[model samples]
Structure formats: structure tokens, C-alpha cells
Target: MKPTIIPFLTTRKLNPENQETPIHFLPQTITLKEYFFIRNHFEYPTQTQEAYFLPIVGEVIRPIIFKLEDIMRMPSKHLMLPLECSGNNRAFFHPKVYGEQWEDGAISQGLWKGVPLKDLLALIGLKRTALEVVFEAYDYGKRMDLEGDFHFARSLPIQKALHPDTLIAYELNGKPIPFKHGYPLRLIVPQWYAMASIKWVKRIVVIDHLFKGPFQEIDYNYYPYKDSDKGKTPVAQINVSSIIQQPQSYSILDNGKHVVEGIAWTGTGVIIEVEVSTDGGESWHKAILGQEQSHLYSWTFWKYDWKVSSKGEYLIMSRARDSFGNIQPFKAKWNRKGYGYNAVYTVKVKVE
Candidate 1:
């Protein structure tokens, strides 16, 4: 196993390990490549420049193979998108759940440059019968709970697959993607959770029916309580959420005034407002919103100033609301898989 290069990120291991960026390092609009969160289901695959080729097959007019040079020759698109793990904030679940116990750091925004997946799909000419597009990655390994080994694969609806913003990314933050980040090529599904953006992409297959892979059908799904009427749904887009990045949680500060800052993001729409509560949930104050990228998929930075009149223990919390009227819930809906935990976040600190 490769050691984590980012010293500050928290690492969790199963068969393939994953790392999350620290909250304190999230103030910047564009996260550095080194600090980007890493979630791997299998060991990173090794690909040489000479051996890289992406095959597009299954329900298509003509099966086509795209080499790295071919993809680079296509018109490139650059987008600043925020990718969050569906299981972000899973650590806060009341009953401890299985899987990565991510806090608020399993997310990062980056400028990605790549060929639009639609452009590639156009090259192969998708048949009218194609209903779903399956993306296959090179990484393969065994699961602790499952019986045999399998490669990572996920499918997106025909509409999402053809979305102009969806990309087969080759560059991250203007540089060639690092080896740990899928190197030559990866999928970038703009408004969806990072799981939908398969890394180390080696094949794109158009199918006439929905995919039933383990990662799609069994895992990455939200299983609600038995008594609830809500049926099981696949985890996709991010929920409205906010986090406190500045004034590290539980830090001792001199009595005076301090500025609290953090980020707010949503996959449904643009984040319009963020509210911060200094004393738990008793009173709330609106935070000053910072300039955000024109892209609706990017995160909005926000800050609020708090005047500390005396020294005492305080609970700080933040909640975000999106343009679609979706707001962070006080208590996240529980699910067996611990996916999409986007409840209001709170941190306790002391003033000396």
C-alpha cells in the first residue's frame, strides 16, 4: 500500500485505503491537488503512456477506441467543480455505521480539464436503444463482505451521460493528474457525488438496461428505516451542507473577537445563504458570503465575525440553504449505509 503524501489528512483503511483533507485546509476556493480527498475501492492501477486506450463498446453504432493522444486532440473543457463523498460526515451518525467515518473533509473543489464525454459519445454514435452508460475503471480488488474480486464500475442514465458538463478528465488544476488520482484519465460527473466519477477509466459501455453491479445495486445506496415509506435509493448528488473551517474546533482563544469562516455547497443548486450559530442553536446570524465561481457546481465560501464579551464554552454551528430551497436538516435522515449525512455541523470551543 502507498503511504499518504498529505500529512494532515486522516487515513482510513480496508482493502484500499482512503484519505480526507482536514477542515482547516478548506478555506481556499480551489483545493490544491495534494490536499484533495482520496477514496479508493481497490488498489491503484498502473498504466504506461504506451498502453493507455479507452474503449467504447456495447449499444453503439460503431465501437471506437480512443488513445490518450486522440482524447487530447478533442476540444477541451475546463470546469471548477466541487466533488463530495456521499458518505461525508458519516462519523456523526448516532449509531456507529460501517464504512469510512468521514467528518467534513471528504470534499474538495478543483479545476478539471478534459474532453466532454458527450463529444466522445458523439464520435461513437449512441444507438437509440442505449438507456444507460456504464463506466469501467482499471482498479480491481476483493471486498471483505463479498465473495469474488471485481473491477470498479458504475452506470449513469442516458441523459446524465450525455450532459455537456460530464467529462473524461485528463488534467487536474492545470497539471497532468497525479498517479494516485487516476493519472491519464478519469470521469468527472459535475453535480454528482465523487463515486459517480469513476477513476482510472478504461472502458465506456453503453447499455440498453440499468447496470446491476455491486457498487451500483448493493453498495452506495441509501437504505432507510424499515418503518419508513421511503424506498432504497442510490446515493448520487450532494445535499446542502456547511462546515466551520476557521477557529479550529475546541481551540482556546483569547477573549475578544474572531472571524469564523468555512464553506457551503450543494449539488441541487447554488448555495445562497449560510447561517452560523455561536451558542449552539439558540441564536443564529447570517454569514457574509464570498465570491463564488460562476459554475453552480462549485462551493460558496462564507464567514461570520463573533464578538466574545467574556470567556466561556461555546458551541458553534453552521447551516446552509440552497437556491432550490433545500436547507441542511437539523438531524440527517438515517440510512443503513450511512450515505448523504448532511446535518447541520456543530463544534465546541472555549474562550480563555
Candidate 2:
């Protein structure tokens, strides 16, 4: 069966095509695999499942190679993780930035099944000198900005790599991962941006020092200003954000009461509350929050009752607050690369 991917702007050539899910289709507890957003940095590899093998090397006491079956034989874990592209809301940035023009659709939650990454680390026995773990994927291609061809690679500090929730996921939402979604295997890092979760993973290298790959040292880094003394910081966890899924932008609705709903999430911590404003930001009301299956990594659904009494246009907005006291800003903080745009989302709707 063909995947049910919602269409979005294609940021790159045919290989690294990008697509996002529509906000109206995101009210469910778990986003369907077909509707999940796809952001590829390279073409999907055609490696067969049986030919897939993961090599664990570098500063490990015993370097080991794991085939698909070998990993499947290990203890399996299931986690509900919501993965968001660091540039999810990049389109809203002022002055127009380079890269994908993603809106709120570049986020989705899924039940991932795989072996804990720590378990694999334990089996290999990390050397005392190991400081960071690097993940490499089969996808490789040349970019205009970079010289020569390079495979997709990223690294994590030893602490985050060893987190219990980290997994080598092979299944998404109870089905074998689709090729577009990763296929045989991928890394799922809970609470982090999707960039940290390398897809089509082929190798796990435990290094004694930081891994300075292009992705880690360049592309994903964030710079606060166009010209600043402070260097760019690596994009890691997601910021607090929410989206109004119902009564989508420019939708015409009957003049009556309607329940406005959407999903809220954060990588720093659990979302504490979500507030809704019908009259732009002039006034706000607390929205009813829903139960979260994964308190730390999954998105929380929220709803608000709107009693539209007049026939006119309304500017509906939604902002979320996380447990860490971080709330979605009225305007997104402008960054050089246009990463992490978590501004309060506003949609204009007509009531008649």
C-alpha cells in the first residue's frame, strides 16, 4: 500500500524531498505512519533488510557487528516519542531564511519499538575513555555548501547516549518501519529534535573526544544573530510549542460553538498548560489539556470551547507553556539558520 503522506513544499531535489502533515489531521493520540512528516537529507537507501548490519566500534572494549536479527533478539522496548524537525516552524521567520519552509506539520508522535541503546552499549562494554557516541547512516550525497560526498552522521554526549529511552528503533506504530521512515533500523532519541535521531543507521562509533562531523559542527548549529561573538550552539532538545489543528487557517465555519483542539509539546519537559485566544492576543483563556502517554517525549492534546456569536473574521491563537517555565513567544527568536521557530501560532478563520 502507498503511504498517505500529506504534501508540502519540496525543499531540495528529488532525493532529499521534504513533506509535512497537515495540522487538521493531527488531533489523534498517535499520528498515523502515513501522515507522518518526512524530511530527508539524502535519498532513501535501497539496502535490503537482510543485508543491513550495524557496526559498533571506536573506543569500545569489544567492537561488535549486529545484524538485523541480532538486534531483534535483544530485549525490546516500546516508547511513545514525538519527533519534531528543529526547523518545524521555519516558514514563519521574518526576512525569509534558507532551507525548508516548514510550518507546524513537521512534527508527529509515534510508538517506537526497539532495543535500548544502552543495552547495546553494555554488550559492547564502553572503554573508560569513551566520551561521545557517533551515529552514521547509509544515506550519503553531495551538497553545494560542502566539498565532496558525505554520509549523514551525528553524535551525542555519553550522558544522553546512555539515556534509557534511547533506542535503535525498527518498528514505528506497531508496523515494520517503512523505507521512507527508515526501514530496517534507525535511532530514536526521546526528547530531542528529529535531527538527533539518525535514520538508516549503519554504524555506532564510541569516541574518546567529540565527533566533529559536518552535521554536528556546521549545519544543525544555531547562531543567535547574523553577526555575533557567541558561536553557534548545536540544536538539541525541542522548545515549547503548540499548534491549533482545528479551524485551520482561512477555514469558514458555522456561527456557533465549536471545540478548538490541537497538540502541544516540549523536549525540555512536559507541557504544563496551553492557552487559547480568540481575539488575537487581546484576551486569552486556559485550554483543557489531555492526558499524555509519554509525559516527557510525547505531545499533549488540548482543547478549548469557542462560542462564536457573530459573523465575522477571528484571529485564533494558541500558546503552550512547559514545566520549565518556558512559553511560546509571541514572535519567534530570529536565528541565522532559522532553526527552532516555536512562536505562538495564529490562524485567521471566518465565522458565518
Candidate 3:
């Protein structure tokens, strides 16, 4: 069956299927599956739930193959998580990074139901020498840079893999995960960017050494020296960031009271504050954080009431600060691959 596309999402690519969410109009706490942003590196893999089986092997005393029925009968866990594309807001990067030019909507939060990966590891009896856990997906395609077709795979540190929150998810928002997202099973790695959450998971390999796949060593690594490959670091945690959902750029409004609201999230810790700027960063005020309950890995809502009396163009900006005191920077550090662009979000609006 052909996947249904929402009219509001901004289309970036067709074959691999990348779309940005229309976050401006979405005011709900949890993003619906249809409205969530879609990011894919290769063509979607076709898998039948009845025929699917996930094998866990390597660096384990008791490797096991689990079918969909076995997974469903195991213990279940639920978590509210926000997943953001590593390249979200890549278009805004200075020097024009070459990749998907996503804006602010490449993120969405959902309640995921699954079995804890730690439980799976416990059942498999992870060996003491295990260093990393690699997840291989069924999706495979040829890349222009690589000669042969490669399966979409990524690895997480053994500690992260054993974390209680890491899950092998099968359901999204109380429904079976859509094929476009990840049907039968997908890994949900909290705190880290979504790339670590490999979809269409076919195999899990616990390695005694680091697993350096193309997605790990080549693409997601942040090259600070732009032209050179020195001092490059792996992109892991999501940087503290905020997006101005309402009063979009180039919006014209009458001079009066307006409620400017948005969302802020961080991978390191909970977002404690979000500040707003109306005079192009000249002055700042804290936005009132919504009283709604938010989980550790979910985005927090924030709003500010602005009463404008003068008529002119106003540059509205929002900066978020996390519990760890990591605040959004004026301009995100430039990188070659354009991953993790978390600069303070700015939107320009006119007041009549």
C-alpha cells in the first residue's frame, strides 16, 4: 500500500521520503504519527510482520532469535520521547551545508511502547567483553559515495545499549508502527539523536570492539575544520535548542498583545528555561513554561505574552537553557556534514 502523505508537511525528497512537520499549526502535546517529521537515508524496506525474526548474536553466551509473537509476549515499557533528525535546521547553517535543507519542524514527540533493550540483553546474557551493540536494518541501497549497496546500521555503546530506557519499540502512540517509520520493530535510543534508533531492525550484534559502519565513522561525525578531517567528533546528544512555532517569519500582525509560544528540548537534561528576544537580541525575557507534565525525554512547551505598541519589523528569537546550564548559542558551530544545528531560532515579523 502506498503511504499517505499529509498536505502540510514540506517535502524535501521523494524516493527516500523526507518530510518536515508543519509545527506551526500543531499545538498538541504528542505529535501524531501522520504529522511527525519523516527522515530516511535509503529507500524503505518491505518486511512482513509474520515472517520477521530478529536475531541477537555475538559476544553473548545465549544468543536468541525472537519472532514478533515472542516480542509481544515479553515485558512491555512505555516512554514519551522526542526524536529529531540530526540535520534538522541544516539549511540555516552558514556556508550552506550540502544535505536536506530542513527548517525547524524535523522533530516530533510520541509515546512509544516496547520492550526494554536491557531486558533483551539480560535474556541473551551479554558477555563481559561486549563493547558496543550494533543494530542492522533491512533497508539497503547504493549511495553515490559508496561503491556497493549498504544496509542502514548504527551502533550504540554497551552502556547505552544496556540503559533501562533504551527500547526495542513495536508500537507508536498506541498503534502499530507505520511502515514508513518502522514496522514490526525499531530501536528507540533516548537522549541521543534519532539516527541511533535504527528501524526495521533485523539483527543485533554485540561486539567486543567499536562498530565503525559508514553511518557511524563517515556521515554523522562532525568535522569542525570544515575543509579538513582533523578534530572531528561523533554527533551524539541533541543540543539544547528552541523553535518559535507561532508568529512565523514574515508574519504581519496588528500592534497589540500577542502570545508567542514554542518548544524547547535538550538531550543532556531537562529544559529549565526558554528566553525570548523581541528587539533583535537587545533585551530578553523568560517565557512562561507550560504547566503540562513533560517527561525527561520530551519537549517542553513555553509561551511569552508580548504587548507591542510600536509598528515596525521585529526579529523574534528564542533561546533555551537546560538543567545542565547548556544554553543555545547565537549561531551554532559550523560543521561539514551539518548535523546538530541548534542555533537560537529567530523569526522576523512585521507589526502594523
Best by lDDT: 3
Top candidate, metric TM-score: 3
- For lDDT, candidate 2 versus 3, the one ahead is 3
Candidate 1's TM-score reads 0.94
Query: Candidate 1 on 1-352: residue-level lDDT in tens?
Result: 9987544767867457699887676567788877888899888777766337999999999998899888998999999988899988898888767778888889988999999999999988999999999998889889777899989999999999999999999999989887778778989998798999888888889999999999998888888964453688998888888888888888898888899899888988789999999999999999999965577688888999999988899999999999899999999998977889888888889999
Q: Write the per-residue lDDT of candidate 2 for residues 191-293, one digit (tens) a residue.
A: 8899999888888999999899999988888888787727778899899999998878899999989999998999887899999999998999999988854
lDDT of every predicted structure (CA atoms): 0.87, 0.87, 0.90
Ranking by TM-score: 3, 1, 2
Worst 10 residues of 1 by lDDT: 6-15
- TM values, all candidates: 0.94, 0.93, 0.96
Clashes within 3 Å, all models in order: 0, 0, 0
Q: What are the runs in model 2 whose C-alpha is more than 4 Å off?
A: 1-13, 49-51, 227-230, 292-295
Model 1, 127: alpha-carbon shift in Å? 0.8
Show the lowest summed lDDT stretch of 10 residues, model 3: 43-52
Query: What pairs collide in candidate 1?
Result: none
Error of 2 at 297 (Å): 1.8
